[model samples]
Target: MDGYFPGTQSGPMDTTETFDSLVRAEFSPRTSYLNTASNGLLPARAVTALHEAALMRAEGRPLLPLHENVETCRAAYARLAGVPADRVAAGASVAAHTGLLALSLPPGAEVLTAEDDFTSVLNPFHVRGDLKVRTVPLERLAESVRPGTALVAVSAVQSADGRLADLPALREAARAHGARTYVDFSQAAGWLPVDAAQYDFTATVAYKFLLGPHGAAFLTVPEDFGGLTPVLAGWVAGEEPWDSCYGPVAELAHSARRFDLTHALFTYAGLRSSLELLEELGISAVHDHAVRLADRFRAGLATLGHEPLPAPGSATVSVPGLGVRQPELSRAGIEVADRAGNLRASFHLYNTETDVDRLLTALEA
Candidate 1:
């Protein structure tokens, strides 16, 4: 599987130098966080922004500038996702935006998704009394589309298996059934390529893979879906947030800005800094770096008599024999996550092939 980048294989690049050295070699040090999608290591730009935001907050400045920052970030993110600024919505988290979208749908509408969908997806459908919820295996999503399916929710990369879904095919099936498509891009946004205009709504958590702080997220709603209401409506969604009286909810901002829960200057400042780091690093190259490292990792694990997931082009590697591999690899400073009966190792720009070899050699011992 292509984890980092498929069809791009050179030799192991140096990783022993300081993290700062690696960052300067490319772009900002923050851009090289190998665990960006998992733990959200902050980028340098975001760090600076957070500092500025914190200082402003300490001085008791108004928080409205954060709303403007969200708007600016939305426009910048739209460019990255190849969509217009109006199609994006900045929010505190994916769950917050999902709540907004769920409110807009019919009361009794049906929501379909894979059983492996992330936890936030269950919030809207499971809590509602009238919404009909149905879930099948991840493999069945492609063929499960039918009438009455108001929305087909999915994760672009399954957090459980790190498998990348066939987005185009899913989009086609959802469109055929007149169902809206919602993708949780928390796992796919930074490590891989994503386009929001292709789907009805794509929610992204900036903390994951984007190398930003927590509580920063974005939702992309197509112009056609403008009728959807914001469940968490506030002064932000109104035509003029400072307006004394509420009006028609400001028509939902005509952009992702409608999803903003409240103005959060410090967090937004941090996230914007991380976005700037990504802009400097060139995502195409970043994808290549991650794929190469993950490929080597997978190969090394295989040589040690462990089998990874069967899919191709996925960065996640699942190693069996936990008792044997975990302790040995841990001693070598290699950390991995365990999920769904598999040992998961996620590779990103900061990882190197040497790190892979080190883990495999530990297993050999």
Candidate 2:
């Protein structure tokens, strides 16, 4: 498997040995873990971090102050999203932030989205009775933007098909219409470079690609954006949450922390550890490795007389004829998903050429 794909390195520094070694060291060695799009596998270090934090709390000697740990996790997510720490807020889930962002828009705002986009991206706007929601195909999203459209919401990557959205083009169209962009990067954040500065608001759940627990997520909002108010405000959203009880007037924080929700501290602890690991590995390397593996997997499927769905540069591949064989494959320790009628295998940095080989062998069987 060493030279299966020539010139697959993203750069001179990216070698298969280094990539595989890191994956082997950090991730749990499963027979094959090809379902990262659904939920990522936490590294051993992250699991240990969660256990230690829980133990410290049980012993009455916490690892660090809760606020300090929260800030640390927020900073880690900020770095991952390539945004300033002040512009990032912690949320319970992508849906929570999406609802918050949708509610922040002006009354009767027109929101343009895609039909195939994640429900979290569309449901928030659709539920607003005063807002005008228009659903179009991803290819037609840019052209669907019109005057008076206040927001354009979409996912960075389609969850089922793994189609990457053209955020730059969408942003350009939205900008021309004076509309803001909201992106859910749940499938793209860890394996892809999501430009947080390009969109007005972006969110991703930690449990999916960030290799952390559920019930905690990160949202990025522009620091200078005005006219947006927190719809789900709590004491954490106040300017001085600790002194909120004594204040006669309620004032929200000047930063994106104004949207913060009470988070699960244990989840944040695991997220901090995993984020640190990802940062150390460099997201570029992780992305390149995942993409390379996906390319190889697609090529393998093709050789097996199974042409995958047309999803260019996607880490997830969908084979046409394997949908019915999903249960058998899973029984054989080859994990994947049956998305509609397509059998989908999602790759991550943890997946290797050997994993692809195993999948191909199972299909042949």
RMSD of each: 4.9, 2.4
Per-residue alpha-carbon lDDT of model 2 for 32-140, expressed as tens digits?
Answer: 9898888889998888878988887899994556556788988888877889999998889888888887778777888888987878878877787888888889888
Best by TM-score: 2
Model 1 residue 206 CA deviation (Å) reads 0.5
lDDT assessment of candidate 2: 0.81
Q: What C-alpha lDDT do the candidate models reach, one value each?
A: 0.70, 0.81
Please, what are the lDDT tens digits per residue for candidate 1 over residues 159-196? 76677888888899998989988888888887677888
The CA lDDT at 303 in model 2 is 83
Please report how far candidate 2 places residue 108 from its true position, in Å.
Answer: 2.9
TM-score per candidate, in order? 0.85, 0.92
Score candidate 2 by TM-score against the native.
0.92
* Poorly placed runs, candidate 1 (over 4 Å): 1-22, 25-34, 60-67, 244-252, 320-332
Best of the candidates, lDDT: 2
TM-score of 1: 0.85
